[model samples]
Target: MKVALKIGYEGTHFSGSQIQPDKRTVEGELLKALLEIGVITDTETADLSSSGRTDAGVHSVSQVVTFLTDNPRMALPRILNSKLPRDVWAWAYAEVSDDFDPRRHAVRRKYRYVLNADEHDISKMRDAAKLFIGEHNFSNFAKKDKNNPRSTVRKVEKLDIRSQGPVIKIDIVANAYLWNMIRKIVSALTLVGNGTRDIEWIGKMLDPDNYEEGIEPAPAYGLIFLEVQYDPEPEWMIDNYAIKHTNDFYTRESNRFLVISTILEQFVMQPEKGQDLD
Candidate 1:
């Protein structure tokens, strides 16, 4: 059976999702676990593939991977999680067709970028985001690939900017994306919010041929691969136990970060007291 699994991972420590020769990566660790569990003798027999590649420090809660397995029982989410690491795990899965390609079959992909609301004009960001709601040549906003060139034109089905407490959330849904597309868009929108750029600048950026300027992408840590939408969705088998296990790991990590933030806040409040000045 060819099986698809919904994967989630904290990519901070990972080189990236793809397999790299010497560095640690999400796919490398995943394939190792699969091999240890006797899922398949090796990767060649399984023909594993992912929905898309995420850059280092970028996280994902809805990433998907598909592979062939002779023993379906060994591929269960709970069974798979037994060998997978705490940072990367399989939470849900489905038996898919042999020819189903996760990347090509995906109908739409959604991404979320969270930015600190401090000093940003939320209203202006919303205005800037609306400009990206349709088809546009994103050459200026994306990193071009030399090996395999493709059209830079892509349709944005939805782009929403909203303030959520101390952070602003930028949610984007599109048919697909180019390298560094969403991150660069975030940087541009942020410039508008902070008064460095305006709505007209955004309009000009979309017309890549007429207006040319390089845009640096926002930090990858703030971006999240939220989900992928598909037509005639698979009959996914949700593993409540696996979900709870993953939740516990995230909750623990969150608490650890919260404690560190509190400690940093104390230093900010009493910088001189904590400092060792000679």
Candidate 2:
């Protein structure tokens, strides 16, 4: 039997999502928690796999993973929560085909990059984002590597830009992404917003004939892996008890973070007007 899990994590403390020999990673911590829950006795038996890798400092709202297991009596979410660090949580699960591969089967992936509204021109950024909604070779806007030197062409289905309170959120939905693609796109948009580039610059960058190596990718901290959409949707649900409580906890946690971040920004940007001095 195999079970699919939907989880989320604050990636601030993790090296990244993939496993390495001596480094701490999301997948490594998850596998350890699985062991404590007795999902499988060994890696060979469990055969775990994740949807894809997330870079360090990148948060994920809905990451999916699957594993083969023989354990019948398993409280997967509850047990995983107990064993996992406070930042990671398993929210839902379902039975899936034995051959299910989360990465291969996903049809679309969505990413959201948040920028401080006070720092950039949100309206201009929104205008520039519209230029990305179609098939294009994103070579100038993606990080290239010898191991990943294949085609940089990819299709973007949607590029939705919106503002909420102090931040401007750019949500990009794509079939798949090349390394650092979203960040680089955001950097380009910011350049346009800040009057450093024109909207036409985005169009020219997508042309395969033009290659520019000066593209500055945005920082990884503000980007998030929003969710992955699968075909026909997977039949999945957490028991009512886990679902209700976990949802409540995550919602509250998110709001708390927003409040704290807003306060920090205000504290730094707007200090007390006057102070008594000896």
Candidate 3:
């Protein structure tokens, strides 16, 4: 039987999401748990795959992974959570078709970049985000790995920037993303916010020949895999309650922070050399 899993992880401790021979990873921990439950004997024969790989220190709220198992005694979510580390949790599972491939069938993937733009210009960051909305060759925005043969051109469905006090959230939805693509974009926006780069700098970087080397990618800790979407099929049953609850929580907390932020901004903008009446 093939099982689809909705998993969440605090990626701060792992090397990355992919399974490594020696280093710790989300995939490694998951496979270890599966082995403990007698789902598969070894990595050689295990048919496990993830929606996509997240870089080291990156986090995930709802990552999808799938694996094949023959053990009828294994109750997936219960057994996996028992054996997995405290930082990783398997929330839900379901039987998927034999032909299902998380990487291939995914319709869209959304990522959120969290930034503490305490003293930076939020408007500049939002303006910079506009450059990434359409389909374009993002070769300069991603690290080119030889293993990936797919083109860098991708359709970005949405890119929005919003601020709540010191935290600036960049929500991006796209069909797919290349390695380090989101991070590089975040780095560029930071430069713009700091007045070091202008809107034209973004245009220049997108030019094939003007792409410069050694542009640093943003830190991985601020990035999160917000969600993934698959094509709507009759057999797919989504847990709407879980989705609504999570989004509602984020929305409430975001607004609370924004209120506090606005109050602080007012104080900062007040004249410091005014004559005191007290």
Please report the candidate that would top lDDT against the real structure.
1
Cα misplacement distance, residue 232 of candidate 1 (Å): 1.7
What tens digits encode model 2's per-residue C-alpha lDDT throughout 104-168? 99999999998887767778888888889999888888887887568889999999888899788
Per lDDT, what order, best first? 1, 2, 3
TM-score of each: 0.95, 0.89, 0.82
Per-residue lDDT of 191-219 in model 1, one digit per residue for the tens? 99999988899999999889999999999
Regions of model 2 farther than 4 Å from truth: 72-75, 243-278
Candidate 3 ranges beyond 4 A from true positions: 147-149, 210-213, 233-278
Cα deviation at 252, candidate 2, in Å, is 5.6
Cα error of candidate 3 at position 12, Å: 0.7
Pick out the ten consecutive residues of candidate 1 with the lowest summed lDDT. Answer: 266-275
Q: Which candidate, 1 or 2, has the higher TM-score?
A: 1
lDDT for every model?
0.91, 0.84, 0.82
Screening candidate 2 with a backbone cut-off below 3 angstroms (N, C-alpha, C), the clashing residue pairs are: none
After superposition on all CA atoms, what RMSD does each candidate show versus the true structure?
2.3, 3.3, 6.3
Compared with the true structure, what per-residue lDDT tens digits does model 3 show for residues 76-186? 565667788866777667788888998899999999999897867889888888888889888888887887577888888899999876689999999998889999988
Model 3, backbone clash pairs (residues 3+ apart or across chains), number:
0
Global CA lDDT computed for model 2: 0.84
